[model samples]
Target chain A: MLHTYLLSIQDQDPTKPLESFGEKLSYGGQMLLLGMATVFAVLCILWACLVIFKMLFHDLPAKKTKTADTVEQTVTEPVVEQTDDGEIIAAIAAAIAMAESECEHVKFRVVSFRRK
Target chain B: MLDAIKNFLGTTGVAQLFADSNWWQYLVMYVIVGVLFYLAIVKKYEPLLLMPIAFGMLLANLPGADLIHLDFFFDDYYISVEGGKIVGTLANDFTQFLQAIPNALYSITDSSIVFDFSEATLASAGTTMDAVNATFQEFLGNAATLTDGALHIKMSHVIKEVINNGGLVDILYLGVKLGVYPSLIFLGVGAMTDFTPLIANPKSLLMGAGAQLGVFAAFFFALFLGFSPMEAGAIGIIGGADGPTAILVTKELAPHLLGAIAIAAYSYMALIPIIQPPFMRLLTTEKERKIKMTNLRTVSKVEKVVFPIIVTAIVCLVIPAAAPLVGFLMLGNLFNVSGVSDRLSKTAQNELINIVTIFLGVSVGATANAENFLKPQTLYIIALGLCAFIISTCGGLITGKIMCKLSGGKINPLIGSAGVSAVPMAARVAQDEGRKADPSNFLLMHAMGPNVAGVIGSAVAAGVFLSFFA
Candidate 1:
């Protein structure tokens, strides 16, 4: 009744197994443990293969910029300040100055000097 | 005129019902059919299959109805198969059996020729009466002879029987008895499925595998409750939550239990939304439920094409008994993913599958004759089916929680409940619950991974059960 990776071959009479309750449960338990393990093993193999394939073929990670690296939490969004329009720059500067005036020690930068 | 009236009254269904001593069976059948009809129609619970099934149940259970009736070997209609050997199979083919012997019902004698059909006896002694002894002996040797000149077989109504008196449901029941319907249904399922989600996240395969814990668990419970192992195997498959698989396994293992087992399985499938949520919530934290799965990576077209072939090779090698259902399922998928065979795929999913589904549902439903479906065992099947379904969802959710923990909160535990193979229905329930937790979260595509995995997992489970006899 012990479940193993190799497929167990049972040629017991179908009717005989039903005759004894303990024997049926033993059969049931064997199937349970073996079936689950087989399922997990098969799926895990596929998962591992997928991970390896992704690692070998997917685009390489982009270099982390100073601004992005400074962004402390994965939950936080990176602030970008790049624009061709003067009006957008003024709006960004106004917002940054407004926040900075409250906390004088705060420092900020326009990470991208080109048009976004 | 009075004699004609009496004869006509005697032939009427009402007259037959009145004369029948088993009136309670009729009453119970009517009530059961009525409830099934209400569920399939009034409540719209899997009406596509259930309504036909309900109607078929009604037809088969009616007193004096020819539909689904077993024509016993009485009235001198005799058929005996001795050791399943046929003495004159070449001489008495089914075609000759169909033609009623051309006014010459010949009997086999122990003579060297094996039949006494000489003109000497044909003229003086028609020999049909005295030949009964010889006929019975040859019958034991698998030569079927009818003194009444009707084609005699056990549970096999011939083409002539169909032309004369066979009902439509009886004709359809052949599909169920021969075990063709479930595999055809799988073909339809394959054509309709998109396995990208599964290919994208193979880890969900474990969730599908985890979900089958219900199947094994329920099997032990059923056996403990004193069901025969075959009967327990049928009941246990309900935990797989795939209607076709349950029906197929029930048909193979315990055909007498098919009607009850199928109805219980499909009823639970229809009620997946109601049955799954409480377990999903009970098994996981709000934080785990709210976890958003990363978007599935797009699978290459080549991968989709290769999947079915690989799965078939691996699974069939392991459990050959599952090859028919799983093979047809993968063939349907191949027809779909090949992209050049839209017509083939459409036919499999829509036309071919639909035709088989009608036969499968009605015929399987017909087997719930009053003598079978009215037992306390039927109630137990229903109760155990519900238990299996709930516990299966729990199994999936428990696995999902573990995966969620291991994946650093990327995997949503709610998607675990989708591992039961009720198709998009189980996935939809997960989606609906996820939306309630976080409106921005969409769990459908992610849940689909486990949903479809449940299908493959259940088929493998069925194969494991069938391997015993195979």
Candidate 2:
């Protein structure tokens, strides 16, 4: 019954000002119901689509397994140790010196090597 | 030399104000502008937009500044064109038509015509039909025609006049009137917002929709208060708690009410941290407030990328009127989530939105001249806007309570208030309340689901109003 009223109200031109108090009341009521219903309906449809997206993209477990497998392989793999090359060490020192020269107000020394 | 000095003095703003009967009104406007400045600066309330808006008000109210002429935009004149030429005698609605003629001339010629007629020319022609006709004939020349096909002049034509002759702020106001700035701001909001929580819990969208209670409720109240349907719709949108959406809806539905509605919407939005918490506590039990739901699942990159696309298609399909706002919003989100358009995303989120915000704020502010801002309806709008915000908060809380019961006490009702869509502020209030209740509960992520959903919900509500009224 309310649906029929909504349909009827929808047909009326909303821009026209309601002259009678009762007509304005009725129209306002119709607008409230219609506006709420439409807002919910649109969002609900979006909600349903998101749910479908969740179902379609349910590859989380597969991706997790792949990541786990990579971790395992990395742990089992042998770590290669390399002796420091004099040329590379000297280049790194020169770069640090250049940087230090640019910021002459600050003094610093290379304390240790860290891999990030 | 003495006569020339006296003439210049007569033309000064001080003399104009002294001669005008409504000088007190300008003083009142200055006080209001000062209050707005205090709110924007000292109180630190939404200052990014508020400061510009207040300054714009100051500009508009300064005596004899001539910065904005509201009469230029008034919908009082009609154009009758025959064979692509204007037909009306200048004597008929001539004063009103003078304001519209530049625009009409631009429309017909497809180029702006400089209106260089001296004030003396207009004054001499005065209300004499033959004299005014001769003046128009001199101006229009071959462009003038005589017949009768009446058509209401379009707003675009009105805007053309502003472009040709309106002051700086008046030209900038075109963005608000044409519905450009709001949609662009939405694009930036989309880029900045994260939809992960919403994607993890799609049901949160319902809570967002529930929060719209205030909008429709306010509309009903405004209508009961004897505001026209268009005015009521504009008033009701203050509940959306989304500033751009309110501005967009008000601009289209009731441009006359734009200043009052924009002030109400933004002020209420800034006050959300204060306005929403009481309603939140009143609507939910301490037990319901402490009930923390499980953590949301991590949304994958693929899902995030697909979310905006799917939402744009679904929403625009259902409510095509929402396409301008929703479409740009999704496009912005897609730019952010796509992970490949970092520069574009950064620009939209920062530079583009900032520039548009200044333009949107000041122009909207310029609309609030003494005549419009000092009205009784402005007070009604402010009151109704507060009612809308409170009711919306309650609506979200009520929905949260319902969902809590349905979910067997897994959902915390406090998070529901975040559905009012004041963005992170509403979500933060929910978190603050949750922490006070349980000391360890973290509702921020959970609340965000509904927080972002409220943005979409409000946009959709605006769309419904546009479809109904625009």
Candidate 3:
């Protein structure tokens, strides 16, 4: 009776293996690394496509010779200056002023030189 | 004693100072000191910055010394006290000063609004009765004290509370931390930029795009090096070589990396004159460098206004992460183009930019605490950052070469390296280097297109990284 009760009470199953929680955690980690690697691979592909586009379209032949016409249309009066320094400075100042007029944030004044 | 003598000399002046030190350590120290002295005295690569950075390197490398301690600002605390009782507080004097200055500036703006006294307050407080009482007291031989009859609470306190609660520091931080100010700085940048040369040649924009290849390349490299996507993204933005853009991207992705990335970006920028010229000259022959660009065409004012809005809509829609930066930049540009809100534009340009700059510089500098900075990883990051810049420059130049070949020698590959968005500096370098190769070559006008385009490209790259990572 005792031997029969012991055999019945043990209820041991030899077919199934015990699984630890660490194995589960490692499985999650592996999945995460895989996901990241996949994302990086995709980005790299997109980057390659961009590089191809830049290379292909960078230099198309210039057909129209509109340089002279554009030059004539946009030409403005050149200012007279007293000296070489004045002319160079005035040109820079005018250029800066034009840039500022367009962009509006840059204020460049000639701090040292007095304008006549 | 002899060994000690050797140690001192080996550590600083001579090899004997490092007699007890390992051979490699002595070599590194000597090389660092020598390079520092050269840069400080000769190259003058930001004497203020390099000087401190060099000194920091020296201080850090010194054995058994805490002089390079990073705890000076971190360990201290500042708190406001009224009548020996603690009231308001901050962690550092910098934050306290940052708070105080803004409040002081605001109160002083319309001095009358804050200071003007009303007769009603005096009347309500019975000031006239108090004066009459004072006369009666004088007659009775005891002077009346003006304390009890009339009392007034200054509105300055109210303003202080409002400004403090509204957080002048936070708003100031918006400019510094969030890069709101630097975005506005684009206005000044815009005003200063000469797109005519670029407009005369739009091909330069391709060079600009080429330069941005470094930013994207850095992202991929960082990923391979085991940085998390977010960190890799933040680190890669350094390739942009634009401080504001770096700050903007880092603030969103990895705020912790802000200080390192900002320092790296700015340091590389200032070092461009030194770092880039050698490479440019090395990569190209004298003939290649001397490729003269055609004269640039005049850009219409209408085109300028449309450019910003179009860029904003397209970029923001495509990369929503870059909206804050690209939005503010275009808005600032719009102000300049519209010419309607001159005052608002001026304020954005000067006062706003200035206020933001000081705060941004100091706060970003302060973020470099010893704990965050003294890691082996930081060394790697700095090295990677330098490599990224060099690689990007090479990438752009190489791409430019391909384009030049494709274009049948019409395009100057030199300007393509300026694509890194160091702005006018990079463009100017290309121009200067081009002239050195051939005095008549004018690449500045052509380089501007790519230089400006590099800005947009870096921002877009940053946007792309942020979108995927953040």
lDDT of 1: 0.73
The digit string of per-residue lDDT tens for model 3 on B232-333 reads 667877888877888877876766676677777877887887778888887777778977655544444545555567667767776687776667767776
lDDT of 2 by residue, B81-183 (tens): 4454444432244334455343322234322222333454445534333444455555443333322212234576577678877898888888888899999
TM-score of each: 0.74, 0.80, 0.56
Which scores higher on lDDT, 1 or 2?
2
Q: Candidate 1: TM-score?
A: 0.74
Residues A1-116 of candidate 3 have per-residue lDDT tens digits of 43543343233221122133443233223323332333233333333433343344322212122454466666775654434442344346434534543575565655665557
What DockQ do the predictions score, one after another? 0.15, 0.27, 0.02
Over A8-107, each residue of candidate 1 has an lDDT whose tens digit, in order, gives 4253445333556666667667756776776666556656655654454332322244555568556667666632243344335434544543586677
* Off by more than 4 A, model 1: A1-12, A16-21, A42-116, B70-166
Docking class of 1: incorrect
Stretches of candidate 2 above 4 Å error?
A1-3, A10-16, A64-116, B77-151
lDDT of 1 by residue, B1-470 (tens): 99999999899888887688877787888898898889889887788888888888887776667777433212122332334333332334433442333234444333311233455644555554444445454433243444333333433434345445557776777667566788889999999998877877878888988898888888778877778666777888999999889988887787778889999998888888788888777787777777777666656566678778877776777678888888999999999999999999999989898888888887878888878788899998999999889888999998988888899888998888999889988987888787668765667788888999899888888887776542
Which residue pairs clash in candidate 1?
none
What is the TM-score, restricted to chain A, for candidate 1?
Answer: 0.42
